[model samples]
Target: MSDTVVIRRSGQAGPTSEVVDISIPSDQVFERLVRDGAVAVARWLGFSEERLADMQLAVSEAVNNAIEHGNKNDAHSRVGVRFIVRNDRLAVQVVDQGTGLAASQLTEGRPSIQNKLDNGEESPRGLGIYLIEQLVDDVELQSDEQGHSFIMWFNLTTQGKEGVDEHHD
Candidate 1:
């Protein structure tokens, strides 16, 4: 499958909110497309440079999880990234076509890097969920038969908007 991106704007005159949705084949190379798309919306929302960096990392990890764990790197499968931009905040959702995670898995304690080393694991690589939570202002997970959706929110603070142009559409 190829990539598909859709942008939708709401409100009259000056739009109050915007939505950007991107779908791509389950390939690691395309993960950047989704991450960049979400970062663009966060930048438009006036997030600080530090926040932008955080968003980039968080989006990357989420997309990586969707591609590696969710889609199992199957090129025929698809992963979707959706960004909802509002005046006050930006919300992102990354979706995958896998069977989805169990509710218990969501509440499990954060993985410990030390434990991985002690257990002789090759790499401490299962920390995506923990890393994403630490970077974003807020995060949540939703799953059904369709798949898992990783939702993240980043709020725009007054300091963040200090120098940004006010005009937006």
Candidate 2:
């Protein structure tokens, strides 16, 4: 689908953002697929190879969170993703089929080493959220009775190359 792959563009009108969407069953097998898909698109957008590894990690963590925590590894569940392409950033939204996280589980900023240690929490939870926020430029979370969605973003530079752009329903 055209919406599944939107390329960058440049003109007198300046840069206009595009978006891509992806949906997959909530299974661990699809984690690699999502990681590779984001990698491919980021590479096409001319992101640094170093950034690729980090983005892959973040994508994997987010999708894995959706599958494991949100959907409880339910194979019948689905995870929806949307990639928003812009002149200087790429935003990805992964939606899972479950209620949202507690506000306390998220941090408004990067957790300090002291915070991580002194929080008095024995569990290794929230590590993924921390990693994702640290790896990307921004992260947003939203949820309702239907599901929860995590939107993560990173800076991008297509370097002003003329590329393909399409719109799909």
Candidate 3:
């Protein structure tokens, strides 16, 4: 199987930016890549403490899904992670080498009763996606004959306005 990976400026008028493209086999390296990428982006964007933690968690979860489900933890298969830092936004894409589910299949609710009765086979699966959606401003899933890609993005401008609030109780 062959994969095409590309990372460049959005090419649509913007401020200074950077892109990091990585291709790693599904293993511990995949997880480390995700963590390091999150840390680098957080530092570059000047993310506050809470925002940094949220971004780390969301990116880690997305990478976990890509490694565990998409690539089946196969050390041979590859996962692609792209970090795009635009003018006021940061977008991260995690692509895997497995068949993907359709966007229609992702709903904002708990598993259905029928799905639950299957001994929770699909119960713990969707939490990562759900948490990603909650943490990031936008989450998108795209798939074609090639493979599946999950994209998560956050607006740095809005985050700056909100500041960091660790204690909400």
How close is every model to the real structure, measured as TM-score? 0.80, 0.72, 0.76
Q: Write candidate 1's Cα lDDT for 1-169 as tens digits.
A: 2555444544443234577777888888888777777677767766667677778888999888888888889877888888776667678888889895634444345787787879988756558777777777788888889988888887766333234443449
Q: What are the runs in model 2 whose C-alpha is more than 4 Å off?
A: 1-15, 100-102, 108-123, 157-169
Q: For candidate 2, lDDT tens digit of each residue in 47-152?
A: 7666776778889989998988888888778888777766677888888897756445468455456655788656456778888877777788887889888888
- What range of 10 consecutive residues in model 1 has the weakest lDDT sum? 158-167
lDDT values for all models: 0.74, 0.73, 0.74
Q: What order do you get sorting by TM-score, best first?
A: 1, 3, 2
User: Each model's RMSD to truth, in Å?
Assistant: 5.9, 9.5, 4.9
Top TM-score prediction, candidate number: 1
For model 3, the stretches where C-alpha displacement exceeds 4 angstroms are 1-16, 102-105, 110-123, 160-164, 167-169
lDDT (0-100) at residue 60 of candidate 2? 91
What lDDT tens digits, residue by residue, belong to model 3 across residues 1-169? 3232233333433344577776677786557766876787788778887788888888888888877887788877788888787777888898888875647535566535566676776565577777777788888899886778888888886553346687767
